[model samples]
Target: MALTVDKLINDDRFCGDNVFQFVAFLPFALLLLVARVFLALFLWIASIILPNKSAVRQMLSTLACWTFGVYVKTKGTRDPRCSVMVANYVSCLDSLAASHVLGTISLRKWKVPPFFASTLGIRNAAQFVRKQHFADCPNKPVLLQPEGGPTNGKGLLKFTDWPFQIGNRVQPVAITVERLFTNVTVHRQSDARDKFPWSDALWFLCTPVTVFQLRLLPPLERLDDDDNVFAARLRQTLAEALEVEMTEFKWEELNRGSTATRREPPAELVRLARQVKEVLPRVPMRDIMRDLSVTRSVDVTITNFLEGVTPFTPEPSDAPTPSTSQAQPRYVTPVPTGVFPKSAKERQLSFQEKKAQMIADARKRYIERHGLSLALNNC
Candidate 1:
């Protein structure tokens, strides 16, 4: 069908040859350039005039992404509205993956283009270190690749400088691409000289037909709360999400909490470094401290990290919360009835609609104590 369409477009005998028509239309391409220049200018201007204007930035990002091929997927508990989230950048796919999960409807899209979603926050750019003038714009909560370079599951490379510069604990995520996005990069650069940005080269490459997989874990962290702890956890979680074999040495226990302690280096590490050099080098020992921070053991301290969510925060003292009974068959007391439907499927029942599901409900305490998955069910 596409071949036929192409044929039809090139067939001069038909209404018009698409190839010729496209080239002919170039005479008016300046109009498009003017439009884009203005659009970018207007956005930059509006963003400046309006303080913390998130909606406009979001619209711009969505529109830009709509022109590309991508989307977002979010799981676990997160407030999409949180403007300062840090996440890992895996093949540049984390942004879209999180956006889809956020459930923000795009105000625009291609008539017949790949699915594109976007999670636009603000971008944090620094003042000039050189002579170049830096425009002040809203910071975007984007995915950052801690390992400054790309990693195909080799041991975690020391993270990039962005994590520290951004000052926002990144939401580390893994981008799983069944097929590498190499073509996208190649074609994109090929078109750099041409008027078209070789966007199509990637369009076919990023198509979902062959690209099927879950996004690696997302960076849903508070950077200020715990710096080293969060980054280390994010690295491990990202590795696990991709089913990558992580490297570990003795004293391989993991840190369960979201925060890391300023403790001494593990015995194993100090021992190994000793064997390599008689005199320990006096370098910034942060890396040595970090190596001992997280462990590979299952007993890693995670409980202490996810504390402080009161789903039961009283709705204003005066307002009464209607405690209408849930239609679920109360299993308060498991009275055994041999006749109680041998097949559990027989007892499976539909639940009555819930009016509200709070974000705090997604906490582990809530899930364990209440046995409820506090997520937007329909979503």
Candidate 2:
């Protein structure tokens, strides 16, 4: 299969391409969602009371996983000596599941509540001096999802180079999240713009069960000075392990295309801009479109142009006249013919004055063409 942004990102909420099953399970999913909310709250409180790494805390972590219907099955032993652990990011819960199995601390850059972070074994990057500080903590491997953000399990996004800078030896962990009844394991990229990480947690709670299959590969030592090459090698290893294609896509591309930043102008505004263009043929289409976007009215845009409130370079030549095949006559104001001024003193007309003169001339021509002088006299 050819790789594309759409193929890598999960753009739909329903799995197996079935909407009927989602509708049928809605009521039961809602009930489960409510129950999971309370359970999550309880888990948060328990995490605060119990000490980190205590037997009771470990049990609570296991219980929390069971409560949220998360079953983690791991293969291969994690290296005790490797301080940095790199993983393929699939969902928000990847850290939670990885921490439970490997006893590692996942570095989170985004703002997450203290209770939620504690429950999920996540530490804010702000807590550390630099990411390298994570290696100082004894017996705890520092987990980094170098893909930068989550994607659907179909492909691996290009890995970031910074994660490999923390340590010379890093362990690669391949994670795959699968839902029993549905393919909707995580939120779509479009939904991510508005929704928080907890929103994905809520969806996980609504599902019947989510299975996380983690395969821990042996630690790989950096053979060269380049961190990017090492990061790429690790990315390829994970992609092969997960049986997914490797992609050159980055998380920044995903954010740039989100609904919040990217939007199409309204059809009405475009139509208004075209109308304004007809009247102000000397003004560039972009300038007219810019004014129409804000004013959203042809009359307002035209008035702005007439009053010199909007600044724009007048087109040097008149717009092309319509074809003769059309029945209606087009009145195009002719461009003024003039010789280039030889001296600076001779070309004293300022830009604003020249624009004003052009507008006045166009208005006079329009009035004469439409015989509006007789109509004005009657008014």
Candidate 3:
């Protein structure tokens, strides 16, 4: 429990501290890195020349397993029966464990770790949904982290609906970590720091003995085929199986935490600005610009204007309305011509008279459409 440099060096378990584990696994880790790079290179070239690309991917997957200690568990077989794999994401290593041991393609983000993006491009064994076109892929199995981004393994974020939309049975794969040396879970919202995925991988790979428990749940087949319901059910299933809390925390909230800076204006200002946007939903942009009178396009200065104006903005008459001379012409509705008689006497009928005539005409039309006998019966 006492983690120190001295303890790491002297500890016999060696897995007690990350520093010790890093020292122990440094050589093997380096070798594994080089090996994976070369394997990725081989797969890239082989994919072009080799007639059996699956075989090459198999070899790459095997190499990946050797690089990291990946262990798989399932109810029946290690391989999943479905085409799409949905999992509760913990770290980027989930991609590796699933790809190597399960021999499935991981769907990743637009940006991944440099090591992953550079070697084998992750494209070799995994796929990026945004970057690649995998909708019509002939391959049976593809992996997806419905949570969108990694969590602390204590909470499950909202699941994406894409997996259910795939038109195939979803295999809910739960990847949980049993830490031996260091916490393999990436800290929540640490992605704002440059190259976060790489840092997570370092913690995972340098650990002396980290076992990844990959469990492939029963394939889900929905009758109603509702994306939201299916996604929610699958998320709940994974959460319960993995023993993590299902949360409403979304990607926006996560990124918001990461990018939140001290330079933000007062919370009161932000809340007031939001209220202004809500109430004056259709407020013209030019009016806002005129009120702010901001010469520069910087965000903070504009926010400051909004904060000041929203709370104390006066009524329309009190406010400076846009120039009427410069405003567009108002639209006028044309008067109905023939709903009444053409004679001036009839045309000049009172409002009550007009209403009575319109009602009579409507009743007449309804009676004619329904027939006199049916209309009388209804009455």
The estimated TM-scores of all candidates read: 0.33, 0.63, 0.51
* lDDT on C-alpha atoms for all candidate structures: 0.34, 0.70, 0.53
* Local accuracy of candidate 3 as per-residue lDDT tens digits, 6-32: 111111223344586567767876766
**Clashing pairs in model 2, backbone N/Cα/C closer than 3 A:** none
lDDT of 1 by residue, 1-379 (tens): 0011111111111222356754555455445545544554555555456544456545655544443344443345544433334333233333344444442221111122221222332122232121121123223233444443223332343443442333343444455533322222221112221132234324322343224244433445554556666556666777666655443311111111111222334675555434222111221244333322433111111121223211112122232333435343221222233454555565442111110112222233333543343222222
* Model 3 error, position 205 (Å): 3.7
lDDT leader = 2
**Model 2 per-residue lDDT tens digits across residues 48-94:** 78776557756876877866788899999988889888898888888
Model 2 residue 6 CA deviation (Å) reads 0.7
lDDT measured at residue 105 in model 1 versus the true structure, 0 to 100: 22
Model 1's number of clashes is 30
Per-residue lDDT for 362 in model 2?
Answer: 52
Off by over 4 Å in 1: 1-53, 79-86, 96-142, 151-156, 162-171, 178-230, 246-379
Better of 2 and 3 by TM-score: 2
lDDT of 1 at 147: 47
